[model samples]
Target: MRYSLAIMAIALGIGGAQAQVSPPLQVQEIGSFHVGGRVVALGDMPKREIIPSPGAPPIQMDPNGEFQVEQMYAQYIKLAEPRARYPLLLWHGGGLTGVTWETTPDGRPGWQIYFLRQGHDVYVSDAMERGRSGWARFPEIFASEPVFRSIGEGWDLFRVGPQSGWNPKAAQRRAFADTRFPLAAWDAFARQSVPRWTTTDSQIQAAYNEYVQKVCPCVIIVHSQGGNFAFNAALAAPDKVRAVIAIEPSGTPSAGTDASPLRGVPHLVVWGDHFADSPFWQKIRNNVERWAGAIRDMGGTADIMDLPADGLRGNSHMMMMDTNSDEVAGRIQAWMARRGLMR
Candidate 1:
């Protein structure tokens, strides 16, 4: 999946004069892989394939709307010392591509590079919809005479037309009717999409399983939304996962909802104090503590760290890129090293 970091700056009107202009939105592409477009067959695996190396030339997404490839940008500088264990799978946060794992602007190594240098194989992927992922073909799919007519019929009924409010429950009925055709069309297209993106949790598990079969007993390092996905994936196949490091994961579903599929996996929950102040970061600490407690209660290890107040210069959520990134990475590397996950 290709994760993207979207930065939006809103300018609010002030008094009668021109509104103050905020900083421009700066989007940084994180994930390094893109799989969406044409369909290619990789025998039973479909069109998915791991790129030969991190430096491999970029590949285009297939026309079928999807493609899958893996990149290993950093390599272990030294051989693993005897008794070293599992490799690590590094997953970036939402709106970020895999590049988040690379070195920072100041040349200080990122987590992935640090781990790789310590003798661990590190992998990164781009989620669907961003980066080199295929484009949506809505116009073409809905362009046919019959399709256009069907869409028009629904549109007419929703608006003031001859068949306007054909049903007394027009508001609700129109919404369902109008959405049905497009939803179906997209569903059809998605089915035909190649190097398909994993829409369901099962697909994610399958992908993880495939990778694990080749690199058994791997540790998962997931940031933000990736943390949620990794937790569920680990629960689905605990044997393949050695441990998980979650950096500010999203909360589990509401009450009466299905519990997280974590299944007592060992996890390290890291959060920044900024989450306590920011509205968006609201509930982050609560959520992290909730999961941490659950993991510990289930006989798994769970640790929570608050980035020092001074360490958080800007948004706490951005500590991963802060001036103290190397320090943060060092702490993480020390943890992994203690676990025998790195040389």
Candidate 2:
């Protein structure tokens, strides 16, 4: 699927240093739906006057009513001709939506389109309280306030650069010499960060479990916080989860949890570079590694793809958005093929 420039130019009947263009995607059907939510009923609450928009008149709002909350939203693309045996489900990390798999911060097509072009029907989702999935009231339905991520916090936490290297000016900002992330799009990436709740993990897991039940006998590709949900979802419904590809997963189940459920499942954990530079990421990696080890102990297929070790270095935590994202994706595609998940 790697298109050389000469071949592309010949195919398009053009020549001489032109930018490469992707072929049109062949899709059978495209649709979306909202899944996994419960209704919350309230009573005896006071009505309040609130403005619905800027320069708008205030209206009386009813506080006591039945409300739907904690639901997850999902959109899917089914290819005209699929090469994979089952559909692929993509789950995003914390503070992000299905947008994580759709487009890169630099405006490049992301893994959603990449995998579809690879001939897999793909389902991209917005976890509960994210994106089009909508959010619940804080301290009431959500039980906690939403927490937002700062740009500098992401720069440091995502291993894009050292904390000291971050500057308000992109020109003044310093990044790891070998970093693959698109530094110029750092601010645009920050716009993708949403306000995440600390206490919503259980609700998120529940919704993910329901989602698996709804759209699977499938493989799932998860990143960061979505890793925990994907792992637990497989444990909850082993028959439905064909395989798991976790790219820089931020968390995992406790190492002691019985992983026998995954004995028949294949798992791949992909890591980018610069783990040694962040103690926080180092701890996260160890925790996920221990969980993978536990799965191996249970006779499951749990493999690690350390990009640096594979000589695919300079990837940030957001490898899917990195410059060489397609290369990283090709690696995952190969792993899936080796696992016999691909046709």
Candidate 3:
């Protein structure tokens, strides 16, 4: 059954001080697990002496031990009366953790709760080297150093505002005139961005594929850099992945790759506004477009939801956290219903 906007509104009253979901959304179970990683033993590594913490005794650490690395972390909520046949896996973008689907920066319930109230079991994940999935020793287990995203880079690259409009002071920052992102919580959102590694895509992909094999016959909801992982996961196991919903995905499979395996899987590519302003996003969009076109050409159900063109305007790359996030999620829910994803 489809849920009403009232259910989502009930979730809006969720925050730190006010953590209540009226007529509380029922759930049978909530759990988490670590998936997909290999144990690597580093031989011929040097030993180092370092303090474990402030005012602590120095300990000699041997950097030549076997360690587990590159595993992904996932937490799930199984509704007592789920309305969907399969769980919904929420995958975050680069430099982000599963927190993307949790509470918003503005202190509102995020897509995790929204979809939960909509009657689907939800699984939120922290990709390898992110959040609960700890990082490994660089230049050993990992290929290179990690890259961090600065507030200004996020502000500009995320389309929250132009590069010239960003100011250290929140009051001085100028957002897109019609932006729906809550500017007051920009710093809070930045806190969610973690250090991301450019060279770990292969590891991340392997972990995500393992995750899919572990818990699927499910739909995948991906954002930004996760697009590549989601597409590859589905391609690797189309039988397990029922559908994919990508929001402002920054990358995709090579348009030349055979997409016939996904001809049976439904795909929804959602885009926000202001593509003309960023050449980088334009290139990304065109690439995804070509890939989606390829899927459709192979007799697959590949749909596009251009928010602005659909009359839902003022959205940015972080549309899931925008002021109108619930509305966007509602649109996605409606599409899922049309695709017969709901029970």
TM-score top scorer: 2
Q: Please tell me which model should have the higher TM-score, number 2 or number 3.
A: 2
Model 3 CA RMSD to the hidden true structure, in angstroms: 4.4
Per-residue lDDT for 47-112 in model 3, tens only? 999999999999999988889999989999999999987899999999999999999999988999
RMSD over all Cα atoms, model 2 = 3.0
Question: Clash pairs of candidate 3?
Answer: none
In model 3, the runs with Cα more than 4 Å from the true position are 1-21, 49-59
Model 2 scores a TM of 0.94
Instruction: Give the Cα-based TM-score of candidate 3 against the true structure.
Output: 0.92
Q: Global CA lDDT of candidate 2, please?
A: 0.92
Minimal lDDT window, size 10, model 1: 1-10
Tens digit of lDDT per residue, candidate 1, span 7-47? 12232323332332322222222223322223423322235
TM-score, one value per model: 0.54, 0.94, 0.92
RMSD of each: 16.3, 3.0, 4.4
Misplaced by over 4 Å in model 2 are 1-18, 50-58
